[model samples]
Target: MTTTSSPLTQDELKAMVGQAALRYIAPGDIVGVGTGSTVNKFIDALATIKDQVRAAVSSSEASTARLQAIGIPVLDANAVEQLSVYVDGADEIDGHGYMIKGGGAALTREKIVAALAQRFVCIADESKRVATLGQFPLPVEVIPMAAQQIARRFAALGGQATLRLKDGQPLVTDNGQHILDVHGLRITDPLAFESAVNQWPGVVTVGVFAHQKASVCLLGTASGVETLTY
Candidate 1:
């Protein structure tokens, strides 16, 4: 009789990659944590070895609460000069490690934390890998006053921008800003696109993580975990 194994669910894949990411952590090193469900998995995994690391610098309040709940010490970003590694999840990661993040509306903070890290390790399921970015709506954090103007800017770029709402009101970021989710953009050159959008007034963050691209990616697959290095 022949038997087959059950397929790995998305959560299982996430957990696998999350656990895989632990190898990158060293004792006495401060880990930089990002926001999102996938990163939540990494946080849970990190808690298992909480004593191995000194502390964590979180990119969002939600992640900070989760880290504290799991008994991992959370540090203020300003208090940390640098991090050993930033392990975060990407919404869409391309071949060159360029990513489109901010699905959780934590782009600005995430970018800040990523900037302070020596290396970035992206953890994600295989579904997140793409040939090119733009399938997933790009998130842009902007000041409230410039929200409409930024929307027009994206529209000029052949994309449709919509204000992200929560509970019938505009969602406010941790920075007290608004987010515009731009659709219909095929970002071929992420570095250039990110640089250009950032030059526009009212744009706090463009959600294109080119400057802080991942050095390594732990991609979860149905078979197991695949590690890719840029």
Candidate 2:
């Protein structure tokens, strides 16, 4: 495989990591899929192995549709007992494997599918790697009625919370929840913040993946695919 040299384009890196993720899929195993641009490339890669894997449990409707379009069966997460791997991308990832995800507004389902998988393989371009989490705004899925209250709570925590909007309207998740992207947080304690935010009323899921952190990260760099474990 020819890797892009120094000054690699984002697409090139995504494709590299996306193709590398196929190595984690075993014959007849149910794969867990997540949403986003990088994962879109992974879905494309997965199409080549459609017949080898049994089925896939997607974290969002977008991924499910893509998997089905590529001749890969999309199954309900409830029907699947075990998943060999969960492949997803992150907004920001630290060396410890903790990540800030949900930029696609699929945080709730992504977290659920991630929890069900045996291995969480985060595929991303090198730009996402960070020394600490929270450079990218952390996404928090919350009930519609609680949006303002949650925003206020995040403000109290020194975060600037903004309701995610799409096409001039509030963006709604597959679970019919709204997303609050919180900024200005340099999360030095991911586990503690994740737990604190999770206990807040009306919070569906926090973007922090501290509890279900990645088992491995396939980071695409100018040199090659750099593998990191936590």
Write down the lDDT of every candidate, Cα atoms only.
0.96, 0.94
Assess candidate 1 and give its TM-score to the true structure. 0.99
Q: How accurate is candidate 2 locally (lDDT)?
A: 0.94
Local lDDT at 64 for model 1: 96
Summed backbone clashes in each candidate are 0, 0
Query: How much is the lDDT of residue 219 in candidate 1?
Result: 97
Q: Global lDDT for candidate 1?
A: 0.96
Q: Estimate each model's TM-score.
A: 0.99, 0.96
* Model 1 CA deviation exceeding 4 Å by range: none
What does candidate 1's lDDT look like per residue over 4-105, in tens digits? 999999999999999999999999999999999999999999989998888999999999999999888899999999898999999999999999999999
Looking at model 2, which ten-residue stretch has the lowest summed lDDT?
1-10
